[model samples]
Target: MKNKIKLCILLLFSLSISAQKSNKPSTFERYLQTKELVNVQLIDSSIRADLKYATTDNFAKTILYDTLFNIYAHPVAAEKLAKAQKYLKELNPELSLLVYDAVRPLSVQKKMYKVVQNTKYAAYVANPSRTGLHNYGMAIDLTICDNKGQPLDMGTSFDFFGRAAGINKEAELVAEGILTKQQVKNRNLLRKVMTRAGFLTIRGEWWHFNAVSLSEAKRLYKIIE
Candidate 1:
């Protein structure tokens, strides 16, 4: 009976060790919290510099826009962003990632009004109507730039919500010269960038992408920050 008891205790200890291993922080998580890369620029640098106080739920502080209204998840988001950036760089060296939004600090909601003013897409921009992937800091919306850093015209502006924004249709129109070819080329380039990053485009928006591995994104990130 004593020998049986000892075996049972050993079994329990083994299970405990396994559980501990499973719960340990991930390498991505550690790297997210510590390592910083020179090539990966924070698109929100101006927002972070401007606010200087707000932080995302995930602890990524605001850099450009008012985080009081839009807090961002920490640079932990840098992992996926880096992956996306790599794809963008390859597609067109001139195109880089610029975060239109990230974490929202409740305090900045008042200031947010000014930012969204008179914009056709303001409703989508102002509040978290749905769980913004940006809230998770796992999503990015970017535009392409020219050698001079000027944004090329995609069929619609970055957050445009209209029929003209249809990716496939616009691609065809641009091909036919119904729309300026550069606009179509720009859209195709953006699509290629997301595809290379392992992302698939949704039917609705040219500017948005869900990381290819939706489950992985959910597992790797939380919504708060």
Candidate 2:
């Protein structure tokens, strides 16, 4: 009877330590590992992730991810993310890459679609029927931040849909007095590191990037459902 009580006490102690260590719920990390995705922090602990969609602060104005907080991505994307962080650190050790979103699941994609569909934001949000690069863990939405983890002014906020958020006409936008040259410079710095890291930028969202082309993503991996 004493041995059983001692064993029970030991089990409780182990559980307490486990609870402290596994900050993320089991299902969360399981999904990440099941998809064969890498936690960004595991690659580069200094790489920060805000996961805007995890909260209600995003464009959708809903809690898309109530449980998920940590950032995860395909190995290819994760490696490139680390490279971007390294490059940024090389350029200015004070700066870090701040991730907004990564490895969006199909369920979350559907929710994102519902919020944007029939609105002007529709074109920007990927339709669930046709999975986005993020679903394959092959894309990232991030920005540059200071050592304090505060993001630089990249003109508009993340998930901002409109001419202000578009990178295609930054020069014209700057000339129009819509976006400042300093803002353009900041955006350019972000582009420099990410492009150097081999991520492709889209004409629409400056924060969004693809680790590989859509063709490569579709051919190489399955979407996270």
Candidate 3:
């Protein structure tokens, strides 16, 4: 009887430790496994890149981008992006900027920028896992056109977050009035096109869109590398 009681106590102790450990973040929590991704290249930049930033512990701020600076998105998110691009072209045939960053290759550096910073929130670090959506390769980040094919203003820079980064908030310095009321209309036009192609937008950030449908919620992944 004493041995059985001791065994029960030991089991409880083990379970308690596991629960505590689970609360702490680990690299494995932020990376996906090889079986969970689909590999493809959808970005049309100088270097096709795709990778997102996140930590194994928490997901307060997730930053997805191409392999280079000022790029974002993954290749798996291409369908909607293509739709948006086509619609944008229709709005302005002269717009000739190409898609740059999508999914990042693991060989590159991994770091998630704090899109929005506050005392309440902590930034996430990058963990390259074979299981991440970028591994499947379909997301993308886009820039606007300079005569030389550079990105233009939406509000904040590519991965910026804050009141100034608000999709609806107007910032003269960052956006250069690019996302004005008319610009929002133009953006909405692109949004409509993407929605038709199966993408959904979040209210807080104008640049963010998700391709997962309600039915595919289970498939929406949350793995650590």
Name the best candidate (by TM-score): 2
The better candidate by TM-score, 1 or 2, is: 2
Q: Stretches of candidate 3 above 4 Å error?
A: 1-76, 96-101, 104-139, 168-179, 182-186, 213-217, 220-224
lDDT of 1 by residue, 58-169 (tens): 1122233311222234354545556666776666666665445443323244344445567654564546434445445555455556555566677676545666677767
For each of the candidates, the C-alpha root-mean-square deviation to the true structure, in angstroms, is 17.0, 6.2, 15.0
Better of 1 and 3 by TM-score: 1
Prediction-by-prediction clash tally: 20, 0, 31
Using Cα atoms with residue i matched to residue i, what is each candidate's TM-score against the true structure?
0.53, 0.87, 0.46
Lowest summed lDDT across 10 adjacent residues in model 3 is found at: 48-57
lDDT of each: 0.51, 0.88, 0.44
Clashing pairs in 2: none
As a TM-score, model 3 comes out at 0.46
Candidate ranking (TM-score, best to worst): 2, 1, 3
C-alpha lDDT (0 to 100) for residue 104 of candidate 3: 45
Compose the digit string of candidate 3's lDDT tens values, residues 98-120: 44334444433234323324434
Q: Candidate 1, residue 11: CA error in Å?
A: 66
